[model samples]
Target: MRSYTADYVIVGAGTAGCVLANRLTEDPNIKVILVEAGERDRHPFIHVPAGFVRLLDHPTVTWRYHTQADAETSGRAILFPRGRGLGGSSAINGLLYVRPFAEDIDSWEQSGANGWNFGNCLPFYRRSETWTEGSSPQRGTHGPIQVSRVENPPEICGAVVQAAQKAGLQFVDDPNSDTRGPSIWYYQQTRDGRRRSSAARGYLRPAMGRSNLTVVTGLQVSRLEMNGTHVSGINGTTSADIPVQIRATREVILSAGVIGTPRLLEMSGIGDKDVLDNAGIKTRIALPGVGNNLQDHYVVRLGYRVRGAGTANERSHGLALAREMMRYVVSGTGVLTYSAAIVGGFAQTRLATRPDVQFVIAPGSFVAGRIGVLESEPGVSCGVWQMRPQSRGHVHLTSSEITAAPTIAPSYLSTELDRNTMVEGLKIGRRIFAQPEVARYIVDETVPGRQAETDEALLQYVRDNGSTVYHAVGTCRMGDDAMSVVDSEMRVRGTTGLRIVDGSVMPSITSTNTNATVLMLAERAADMIRLPMAEHAASTYSKESV
Candidate 1:
């Protein structure tokens, strides 16, 4: 075995892992090894803001896991694409920068995750990004990640904003500031100039210069190396199938995301006894919550055929695309710099007090039931989803092998409230489109057309058409409960020197895109692990002083 050692071994050089590696290594005395199963973030498309569409399904950069076929989804397994490279999903994700509401994290504290309320987390969120408008109480200015709002959005986006305002939603200058009640706003992108500011670019690259940090890519970790209840390190193999062993003298942190983390735990014999036995592994921790509590934002898209306005579909092909390429090269602007959505908002349905529904508008439309492939005709697409879904699912290893795909069951639209909320959210989308400002575009609802009018019809349409928004979370949930996988400090229960600092540790799925929260969570986790050591050192007196 090719052996290596570090004070901290971090599995998965993803959103959280990158932040942890950067923060921990700042001490210079701390050594961190961040291992990624996928390649480095060298793919050309991974840098461009709009290149996400290409990387979403790219074989090299994404792990195209599919949710198990369920009755709620009309018995069809839905594609769940996760980034596989250094930045993980951050590199392949839509660059929209959204944060969860205060109430979202407060609920985490209420759910036995002590000291995890929004107030305690805001500073870490601020520490993760540099907003375009500079530092403010509500924004960050000196962070590694550079965030900017969409400037001079296409006319269709303006129309959508007007339409949303007409539909009883107030337009906000910064939706990320106060995302409560009904509101519409332009989206901010995780971009530095024309390039996407993935976690690798924001945190890892800057920290790579540190001699204490080591990044090993293309090393697929199979299982943890444990000495009784304490995690020692990890065992894995390189891309060439060369056996490798990494020893962690201090700790082993898992940031392999929602699906990967739990699966890793199970593979390492740290999950439920029944699951471990069935998977042909001996139980180490007997944590039943390792792969349970899976939650994701399920969305249904409404496509429209437009006439008066030019959409990305027109500019994505022929001479127009050539012009866009030139525009991107020269002025660093054009359709090539567009994010997954130009306009997005949050609004309340009858289901909840805060915004129960979220909306995202793109100045282009994709084919029905499939994304990435734009329609030949000019069109617009709006995706709406219930922000807080009650539906939960689980992820389990299909085989004992590390390379085998897990069985993920999202159980989308599995509840009455979820179904009703989705129907209502879809109605809100139609209402926004029906406004004169937007209706003047003379676009007809193409997907679940006007023919699907009743609630039942809309509900049926959602069952057949709804898909993941790529925000899977809450699998290895953190709580002080019996079924909780990790504790408030993100340490695995019944285990020593092991922690999970990713979205999987969330008590529940956030009310918005999870990347921002994941980044903040890592920042906080690093402090939790380091601050105590600093305090202990500071309190110790020298022999002369004593």
Candidate 2:
């Protein structure tokens, strides 16, 4: 067996892992090792902003975990694609950057996650961001991640923005600001013009050149090697099935994301005892919350057929492609650089205090599980997602063997509240499409058609075809409760020198995309871990004095 050692051993170099590696390795005295199950992020398509359609499902860059038979969707198994590379899901995401609402973070504090409220986390969010649209007090321009606006948006995208204004919603230039209710705005992407700016490209790539950081690819961590209540090391296998052990001098941080992190904990005998006993493994910790509280956003595509020449089909063929390519090559301004989802906004499905649904307007039809249906048809597609869902689910070990895939249960639409919200979101979508400004571009509804107008019909349609927005979180939730898997500082409960810093640690799901929040959490985790012992002592003394 091969053996290695480091001051910090980070499992799974995805979004969080990359950020942690970059921050921790900044100090030459701290030796950091980042292990990833997949190969390096060298694929060409991964750098293209619009190539996410293919990379989202590519097994080489994605973990490709599927959910168990969902109760709400008539036993349909949903595809959960997690990033398996150096940058994690950030490398293959839609790149719609959004911070959670203040209410969402306040809920985390209410759920026992101290020091994680919006007021406390706002600085961290700004710390990791580098917005191209210039600096604001709410946004940072010197951060590693580059966030920018779409240069040239489609006409329909603009119409949606107008429609949102006509609907009496606020139109804010920066949606991540303090004015955080409902708004219409141009989508912000993590791109430098046409090329993608992933966490690996922005953060990890620069840090990898340091002498103290070691990045190991194609290493699947099997279990945590613990001595009593303290974690000693991690055991795993290389791509060639070679056994290896990585001893951590200080800590073992699991940045393996929602699916992989909880799965690792369960495999290491730290989950619910009943689950471990069934898998024939000796119980060590028996934390029931290891794989509970699963949450994600589900979206139903609403497609429309255009009446005239204002669609992607007319702009994707022979002469059109040539003209656009020339313009794009000469001035870096064209439709090829960005995805069809140019304009999107948040809105309340009902007259509630908070926005419960989000809509993304794409100038192209994305159907058949992202195979891009109706490419030849002159139409646009709108995706409606029910945010802040009440439904919860779980993840569990399928077998004691490390090589076996874990069982995932997302339990989408498991609650009546979730169903009601989805149905209401569909109605809201119909209202937007029926508006005079938006109605001009549409000839007919190609998805559910005009027949499915009532609540029951919409509910049935949602149950049959709703798909995940690819934002899975809370499998290793952090809190002070008895069932909490990790604590507020991200340290695993009932253990020493073991921590989980990923989307899995989110006590509750954020109302927006999770990539930005995950990266920010990783940044905060790195800072917390890197604080000098003297500083920790001083801070503790100061708190006591207060």
Candidate 3:
């Protein structure tokens, strides 16, 4: 076996891993090795702002895992694509840069994640991004990630923004900073001009030259090397099936994301006893919450046929596409720079007191039940989902083999509140589309047409069509509860020299796109791990190897 040693071994060079690798390696003496199961983020499309559509199901860049068929989803197995390269999902995600509500961060402390409240987390959130609008009391000025407004939005998206205001929603200047009530606004993206500002580009790229940081791709970490209650390192095979062992002298950080993190723990015999037994793996530590509390935003889309204006469908093909490419090359503008959604915002349904539903409006439509493939005809679409879903699920292993896909059951729309919220959220979508500003551009509703107007009809439509927004979180949740997998400092419970810093550590799903929140989580985690012994918990944050 080929063996290597590092002060810290961070698995999964995704958003969280990229941040951790960059931050921890700041100390010249702290040798860090970042391992990724996928290839390097060198794909040309991975940098284009609009290329995410192509990257979603791409063979090498995504894992392409599918969720288990459940009653809540009309017994359909949904395609769940996860990023596989250095930047992980951030390289393939919609470049929307959105921060969660203060309440969302505060809820972590309420759930036993002490010191993780918004007040404590704000600095980290601010430290990760440089907004185009410059610095303010709530926004960051100089950070690694570059966040800017969606340039030259199409008329259809503007109409949606106007219609949303006409429908009684307030238009906010900066949605990320302001958290008042229901509001509509133009979306911002994680882009430095025309290129996507992924975590690999923002954080990892800057740290690559440092001798202390070693990034190894195409190595899938199968299991942790355990020394009693402490983790020593990890063992895995390269893409060519060559076995490799990376020993972490100080700490082994798991930043493998929501699905991958729990799967690693279970495979390493550190999860629930029943889960390990079923997977034919002997139990080590009985952390029942290792793979529980899976939360994601299940979205219901409403597609509309356009009347006069041309949408992305027309501009993305033929001579129009050529013009867009040329425009991008010359001025870095046009449809080539667009994100998944040109306009997005928060809104309230009749059943909620606050802005419970979020909207992702695009000037193009996809096939009725899926995304990525735009319709041949000119059209627009709006996808709405409950901002904070109460339903919980689990991700568990079915076999002991590391290559076998884990069973992901989100149990979407499993609760009455969840079902009701979705139903009403869809109704709110219809209302926004009905407003004269947007209605003038629409010929008619193409999906779940006007016939599906009633609450029962809308609920059925939601069950039949709702899909994931690609924001999976909370599997390896952090809290002080008996079932909690990690502590406030992100150290894995019941295990020394082990920690988890990723979306999986979120006690609850954030209120917006999860990429920004995941970045913030990793930023804070890096601080907790690198801070002086006197400033942090000496037991969890240690400089020397345990």
Give lDDT tens digits, candidate 2, residues 398-447. 68987788888888898888898888877777777777777888888888
Instruction: List RMSD in Å for every model shown.
Output: 4.0, 4.9, 3.0
Candidate 1: Cα lDDT at 393: 92
Can you give the TM-score per candidate against the true fold? 0.97, 0.94, 0.97
Clashing pairs in 2: none
lDDT (10s digit) by residue, model 3, range 1-546: 788888789999999999999999887778888999999889989998989989888899999999999987899999888999989999999998888888999999999999989889888889999998879877897888999998777777878888999988898878888865888988889999989999999999999999778888889889999999999999999888889988888899999999999999999999999889999999999999999999999998899999788799889888988999999999999888989888887888777778899999898898884678888889998899899999999999989987899999999999999999988888888888899998988888989888997889988899898889999999999999988999988899999999999999899999899999998999998888887633533222232221
Using alpha carbons, what is the TM-score of model 2? 0.94
lDDT of 1 at 141: 91
Model 1 misplaced regions, further than 4 Å: 535-546
Residue 285 of model 3 has an lDDT of 94
Model 1, C-alpha of 233: deviation from truth (Å): 0.4
lDDT of 2: 0.82
Models ranked on TM-score: 1, 3, 2
